[model samples]
Target: MTAIHDVAIIGGGLVGASLAIALEGSGLDVAMVEAAPAGAMPAVFDERNLSFAEATVNALAALGVMQRLRAPTGAIVRIHASRRGDFGRVLLEAAEHGREAFGQVVVARDFGEALEARLSGVAGLVRHRGTRFTGFGAVGDGCRVLELAGEGPPRMRARLVVAADGATSGVRDALGIGASRHDYGQVLMVARLRAARAPDGTAYERLGDDGPTALLPRGDRAWGLVHGVAAADAEAVKALDETGFLARVQDAFGWRVGRLLSVGPRSAYPAVAVRAAALAATRAVLVGNAAQSIHPVGAQGFNLGLRDALTLAGLLVACARRGGDPGEASLLSAYVARREEDRRRTLEFSDGLARITANPGHAASLLRSAGLVALAALPSLRAGLVGGAMGYRGDVPDACRSGAAR
Candidate 1:
């Protein structure tokens, strides 16, 4: 633990932890720094309901992350999408596409527990729990010195540095990698509720002038509700009582799944799209939310970040096997090159979907209806959306592809 490790990863959230798990037996000296105390799960943060794509499920299953979950997972066998006051709609069934299921949904707390269990098996790895990464500076010997505070040593040197600290990443800023952000003027309100009619493994999306209100099935026989409202109405909506809130949701979502019976606590998140100006600089690179954060309308945020982690881990392991320097410019450049298409398409998909639905102009409205009609009337037109939804966008990592023999 005293010697310089090959890589030092900052921010041990799902993405960072996933990268560490992937690099477990790669013969690369790895260390993880997490700000939270060991076994301390943030209640508000843990209340999230994550929508895992099919490809993401494949990768996690291969990594043994999914098998470690103690809770049952909800499956997605069909998707129903429509707009209020619109004539066209889309209904996609997984069976028609030659797949048994699109993906699964799990509570954030459950997923974290699973990751924690698997991380313990990495042989001879270094763990820096409850540690804060102050910043990093070049060591002038092809390595970077990461300053830290907490139980670990004050400083550690590594050839490769990773910033998975999230959207407002101090590590990314320290590396001089700038980011551009677009505020969508929307807030997503999430909650867990029970429907009078039990879920039948179908996810629903109700599009509106501002955003989409989505309902995802959960293993506990409850539905995860993600409601989008204009920024001006966020506070008013948040102040509603349980009964009022349920009424509002029923009004927006219609009676597709039946009346909402009860709702747990609710949380609100501002929908913003963040993109880094550059992916890699010097010996460091960004992954997950630190690299890019998009609207949750498409459920592509975490799935996209997972792919980023898998790609970087796969490359590093291969390079280590060949005795190549993990921090070399060539390796980092290659990592960025490998991720470009996926990043671009995902950004386009997440951002464009929201803008298209939000635009009030007649032309945009017509275009939206036509697109939905095409998706409903022609099966071939649904392939693109289905592929993106199933996490098969661009330049997917071998570990993330369906039926990949990893």
Candidate 2:
């Protein structure tokens, strides 16, 4: 007989793994469906640097994932924002907000390793690694039969299914859920760069004609470089030698982080904004990139997705406590309602930033400079911006509020 799980999460990437960790010891039988093999890292977790919001850091700590990390993390004590050829700049400090740090940066591989380590110790959690979610069928009231493509049992019943399968989610497609996609006509090339000066917990974002270039501090006195290039220029940019690339980056970013010493392996991907038509349907719901994939202008993608996982976990725990069906329409409705504000606000913020800064006109540049000045000069505006950056703009979840997992 196929074992039934209280909740089966599709996609074991950051968001999906996070959801699994958040629900630990919640008295609900949970299963994670992953296409990758156990202990193997996904391509998404290689070399890329992830910036965690303060709320996300707390949530990860509460889930016990932070303690398991083997790689060193860089704290973001301040943010320096500027526009190329603009006189005005904005500096946001954690100290001003009475916080130790606005966020922390971690290499994706390190975080993946931490999540894998924590997953091994979670009791009552089943991991179906190397298994792909093919589709699903209505089994009975408050449950659905999940079909899999792998060596194990082909089908299992799940009371609730959470889709965290990323932007191109198969489960979402199978469900006939439509997504609106907007291509930004830009590609972001990412690499690890060494700088002359040691990192002092400062992150930099420079806006120019090409696009926004971000330098996020990492361990080992290096920085994670995200250089956005126009679609037509992506190939030429990739073809540049290390020295040429460094020169181009220096020209775009100015002398913010001292001299660039060296660069590691590089990877590039096209940027697109995708949002699902609906967040929930029947016994399944979308979370993270599966529900919406926003541009990484403000580094809000994963932070927002982590919030999704945390909020859903809280709702599931509450449902389990009350002996209510996990897949009940009421539960899904409540989950959507709770998350609506945060999701909308984050999507708008990220999309707006991407659009406004991409324009190269003098008027646009002046507007950008004025906005930065406002953020630095106006206490009310600064507070609201900092609050959103720290991931504190929406309904707070218990899992994120507690210092440690219950």
Candidate 3:
């Protein structure tokens, strides 16, 4: 007899692994199909620093993911945002919100390792490493059958198939869903640096005419930087020697972090925004980068994706408790309705911020100045920004909530 699972998760990247872990204790039988080989980091888990929102950190902690991280994570106690060549600026401190820190920071590589360790201990969760999901073969008998290649079953059956496969999701494509894409014409460079000044639990984001340069704190008193450059200039910038590259970073970010004495290997990422036309199709649903891929402007990409995974997990687990089918049309519709608000607001904010800051025109300059001034002066406005940044926008999941999760 061909074995059937309650859920077959496609991709097994950060978001896919997260969904499996989130379903750890649920009665559902879960299987994760991943393309990466055993003991290899997933392609997405590169040497990039990720800024986790407070809610995201809380949720990961609840999932027992944080405790497994071997690398030391850094806390974000404050944030300073400003525009270059402008007098106005906005500052937010965690203390004002009665919190110890706004969130945390982790290297993507370390996070992948931590999640792998956590997954190893998840009871009854099946992992198919180095596997490929070919396409959906059929949907019948209250389940969908997946045609796959590699180590897993050639054919697998599941009540639900979650497309956590990332932006270029084959599952979503197979489902006949379309995605709208926007190219920002910019490339973001990331690297670690030793600064003359210690980070001191603060993160700095300096908006420039060309792009934004952000400095995030690290546990070793160093700094992690994400600097934006024009797409045409990326190669020229990448060709520079260590000293020359350090000079470029120092110029873009100023002396706020003092001298950038040394830098590690650098990676460049092109900024492209993608939004799926729909969140669910047939008995399948999309999560993480599969559903939406936004700019790294506010460092909200992963945070938003995590929320999508958690929200869906909560709904599916509830259905399991009721002995209900995991992939019913009505249930999938409810997931769409539940996620629409937060997803819309996050995409708008990320896209709008990226566009608004990329322009060097007088109008954009004025708007930037006005925004910083309002944030500095109005508590309500500052509160709103912090609330969103902390991942409290709408329909937050149980694990992401405060108190117990905290």
User: What is the TM-score of each predicted model, taking all chains together?
Assistant: 0.97, 0.97, 0.98
Worst lDDT window (10 residues) for model 1?
39-48
Model 3: clashing residue pairs? Answer: none
Which residue pairs collide in model 2, if any?
none
How far off is residue 346 in model 3, in Å?
Answer: 0.6
User: Model 1 over residues 1-406: C-alpha lDDT tens digits?
Assistant: 4458899889888899899998978999999888887877423247688999999999998788998899999999999988876779899999999999999988888898888888888786798888889987566677888988997788889899899989998998898889999999999889998988988899998988768899998999999899999999999999999999999999989998888899999999999889999999888999999999999887899999999999999999999999999999999999999999999999998899889888878888788889888889887778878998999988898877754423
The numbered model that scores best in TM-score is 3
Deviating ranges (above 4 Å) for candidate 2: 139-141
Native-vs-model 1 lDDT? 0.89
lDDT of 3 by residue, 287-350 (tens): 9999999999899999999999999999998999998999888889989998999999999999
| lDDT of model 1 at position 82 | 87
Pairs of residues clashing in candidate 1: none
Name the lDDT value of residue 342 in candidate 2.
95
Candidates in order have lDDT scores of 0.89, 0.89, 0.90
Candidate 2 lDDT tens digits, 223-295 = 9999999999999999999999999899888887789888898999898999999999888899999999999
Count of backbone collisions within predicted model 2? 0
- Determine which window of 10 residues in candidate 3 has minimal summed lDDT: 397-406
Q: Is candidate 1 or candidate 3 better by lDDT?
A: 3
